[model samples]
Target chain A: MRLSLLSDLNEERAARRAAVLVTEVGSGEQRLVREGQVGSDPLAKDLEDSLRQGKSRLAEQDGLQFFLTVQTPPVRVVVIGAVHISQALAPMAKGIDLDVTIIDPRTAFATPERFPDVPVLAEWPDTALPDVGIDPYTAVVALTHDPKIDDPALMAALRSKCFYIGALGSRKTHERRVQRLMASGFTEADLARIHAPIGLDIGAVSPAEIALSILAEIIASLRNERRRSA
Target chain B: MRSTDTDILKAAEAWRREGRGVAIATVVETWGSAPRPVGSHLVIDEDTNFLGSVSGGCVEGAVITEALDVIADGKPRMIEFGVADETAWQVGLSCGGRIKIYVERVD
Candidate 1:
């Protein structure tokens, strides 16, 4: 099949287990173009021709042209701490279609019973990192405050190249952790990647609101990076 | 559309035989009130395309743009969209619910 880069977006969305929306784009003169009819599709171009115009979003189908723009792709959330915030975080993450993976070394917290119908990894950071595969395609969040758990995971995340690596802690905790990481040989640049405190400063008072804060930060990172790249 | 890897390979093999280019798109995530669950897929041919729902037909316009770039540069790109976007309504999904879409082009 002709999976041009445009279509390749669809392909990768599938790889990442993401949902997609293909909208029909046209001017005011053309709006009745139905949804799944190929005849209504604009002259479909392979990725090469598609790249010829990043801003050209005119799809004509059944002789009627539609207009559309490519929105953001789906995101995957890998939470290293499975605490109360996590309980609220999972569904919140799922609300926006993030492929959420909750990891905790504590068996008490990481059981399927606690997080039913979700992907829970009860392994230590080191062991889980490889299995989880921290690719540029994935976002890593270290929620456990335990250095043994969060640090190893952060090290693994830094070693690999995950898009976002957020850690949960207070400003004091962040300072101490920085000292530890600095002594461990991590450079300042590496430390900069960590979104310490792990969320936006919204004065969240509950686990659920904290989850929202974290989700908001992730959203900000994704969009900000997109604008920069664009 | 509903083709498997073997199906894609078979189709790609045919295109390769004909000396044409082939591309692959994989779905990484799906959000609330979505028709297709995450992991659902669709493959596009050089001319004809395959099927399977990704978004509810809202953000594919942008995905196609990047997928083509991946095929041209022979590199991989991670693309995303949905509620998180300020202008997400431009594609009809700017509602509070969001989904992270990653597009990787495999030749």
Candidate 2:
């Protein structure tokens, strides 16, 4: 690997862009392919599959062997609350390599002291999320349980290609939220994307347990092949 | 804090920029219960200082030894380790897995 290529790869990662370092095994010849440049590469199909899955692998073309070092943007979790659950979720998510950011319009809750390790935005999700740059690699979780805060975040997530979107609520509460979103022109299909009653049903009662369940569900949504396509 | 892949590569580039001889060892292939996945990196400077893991510390000593030679010669080498190899007793994976690592100089 060349210094310039390594620097380019790091730049793409910092900018949250995907890239692949393709190296010929025998000759040590290498090239860095950015996300949009894959279409013109000789290993287009393999590169596309590797990027989509965020996995690296060895590929054989003709008689030569190549290693594809697939580098996807780091997975980010955007929580639209600085509540107890978010406090627990932030550190736990970071332990597993998920970059977490907390957003809450209430300055009282979104204090740096509350979330010392994670980024906390004392602004509404509509404003904060745009600067945060939600993309397919991001997971949005609304844990405020307040319509004023959670609803706007959900709306923003619904409009983006975020991989996971969940809102903390009871089933009845979700029904009301769904009706409101439907009234705002989101179809049932769009509403279906939100994992209301958020988290896997593990009978979680405590905030920490709830955070564990939510993280598990997010991992499932990320690694499951079927959900990746959906 | 654990070094992520990005940090490992960045450190490699930084080490080279600072006029240190650097090499990167990557797990290009794995079989069975490999401790680390393919594309996992272990960046080593000429002094044998390393960051990251290609086998969760299983075969790092041997990889670093080989990396020093790669950095000196500027030639890439692919090395394999497994229980099946004769060096298994010396530096093979304790997890009973086989891995192919590619060590190359940061030219």
Candidate 3:
């Protein structure tokens, strides 16, 4: 690997962009393919598949063996509340290599003492999320249970390509929330993308367990062959 | 702190920039119950200092030794280890899995 290539790869990773390193195993030849430039590559089909799956693998092209190192942007979880669930979820998510950020307008709840070692933004989601930069690789969890706080975040998530959008609430609460979002002009299909009554039905009775369930659901959404959609 | 692939790559770049010879060993293929997944990296400096793993703790010694040679030769080579190989008994993957690693020097 050339230093220039390695530096470019690190730059892509730092910028949260996807890139692939293609190495011709036999000849020691290599090339870097950025995410947007994969379409014109000779191995476009295989590159697309590998990038989508975010897995590196060996490929044979024209009797030449090549190794494709797929480098996907890190998966990020943006928790809309810094409550007990976010406290639990943040650490657990970090343990699994998921980048977590907590956003809450409530200063007391968003204090660093409550959530250590995680990025806590004591700002409103509408103001904070843009700087956080929600992308296809991000998962948004509305855990505030406050319409003022959670609603704006959900709207931001819905408008973006985030992989998972989960809201902490009951079915009835979600129904009311849906009505509010509908009145705000979100289609039924668009609202369907939000996983309400959030988390898997794991019979979670405590904040930590609920956080585990939400993390599990986020992983399921992330690892699905196709991106979860309405 | 845990050394993720990002950290490993960043270390490799930093090490090379600091005028040290560095080689990166990557798991290119695996069969059976491989300890580490494909694309796992182990970056080795000239002095045998290494971070990350291609086969958990198994086969790292051999990979690092080969990585040193790659740094000397400026050539990339693919090495394989498995339960079936006699070297596996010496290096001991013990996990009953096969893995192919590619070691390349950063020029």
Candidate 4:
């Protein structure tokens, strides 16, 4: 690899942006396709597929073979409460390599001792969420069950491209929450993005079981989104 | 950073900077029962040091051998292995799967 190309690749990595390194098999010629520049590339479809799936592969276009090396930012999960469910969910998310963060204003609950090594933001979601910078790869889950806290976080999530937004609540609670969101100027389409009564229906009874279901649902949503986009 | 491909690429880059010959082999495609996914990589330095896996022990030895040749010749080769083929058992792809790998020098 040329020094210039290596430096360019490093720049993309530093910026937390996605890119594809295309290497021609026969000639070893290389080019970097930054996420923003993929639209005009000749192998746009292949590059986009690699980005969406976060996988690299060899692609042949008109008999010209090229290796597409995919580089994606890490997936993130931001839990809105440092509750018992989060105690189970945080490590579970980490087990799957999702960067996890716990957010709550309650200092006693949101402690490093409770959620060791995981990022715990002791600020309100309205303040902390923006700093966290949710992106397309982020999964936002609201477990606080407190309207003041979860609602603002949900609003932030809805505005951004976070792939998954789930809230823990009963059907009745979600309906009432819906009325509040509607009154606050949220459209049906926006509200639909929230996975109310969050997590997969596995008849989960304990906090750990519920956490497992949430992670499963998040994974399913991610895979389904990729399939739909593909 | 969690991705093996990224780690392999970084190792290859470092090895190259250290003036060591380096080559990378990547799984380009796979068929039935392939253990490793496409895009999996195994990087080889001139000293035979390797990082990552292409087939979960099914084909790393073969890939490293081919990669050494690629490092010397600077030519990329696409190789295919499968369990259904006559040489499948010999090559150790006995998991009823096939994989296409592209090996190349990272120049």
Question: How do the predictions measure up, each by TM-score?
Answer: 0.55, 0.95, 0.92, 0.87
TM-score, structure 1 vs. true: 0.55
True contacts kept of 3: 0.78
Q: If the candidates were sorted by their DockQ against the true structure, best first, what order would they fall in?
A: 2, 3, 4, 1
Give the lowest summed-lDDT range of ten residues in model 2 chain B. B1-10
Task: Give the whole-model CA lDDT for all candidates, comma-separated.
Answer: 0.63, 0.93, 0.94, 0.86
Q: Candidate 3's residue-wise lDDT over A1-230, tens digit each?
A: 99999999999998999999999999899999999999999999999988887889999999999999989888899999999999989889988889999999999999999998999999999999999999999999999999999999999999999999999999999999999999999999999999989999999999999999999999998877344320
Tell me the deviation in Å of residue B26 in model 2. 1.0
Winning candidate number (lDDT): 3
As for candidate 3, its clashing pairs are none
The candidate with the higher lDDT, 1 or 3, is 3
lDDT of 3 at A72: 88
lDDT of 4: 0.86
Docking class of 2: medium
Per-residue C-alpha lDDT of model 2 across residues A51-170, encoded as one tens digit per residue: 877888999999999999999998899999999999999999989889999999999999999999989999998889889988999999999999999998999999999999999999
Task: Tell me how far the alpha carbon of residue A173 in candidate 2 is from the true structure, in angstroms, after superposition.
Answer: 1.2
Off by over 4 Å in 3: A226-230
Query: Candidate 3 chain A: worst 10 consecutive residues by lDDT?
Result: A221-230
The 10 consecutive residues of candidate 1 chain A with the worst lDDT sum are A26-35
Model 2: DockQ against the native? 0.73
Model 4 bad stretches (over 4 Å): A2-14, A49-55, A61-63, B1-4, B7-22, B45-49, B71-74, B84-86
- Candidate 1, A202: how far from true, in Å? 0.6
Could you give the candidate ranking by lDDT, starting with the highest?
3, 2, 4, 1
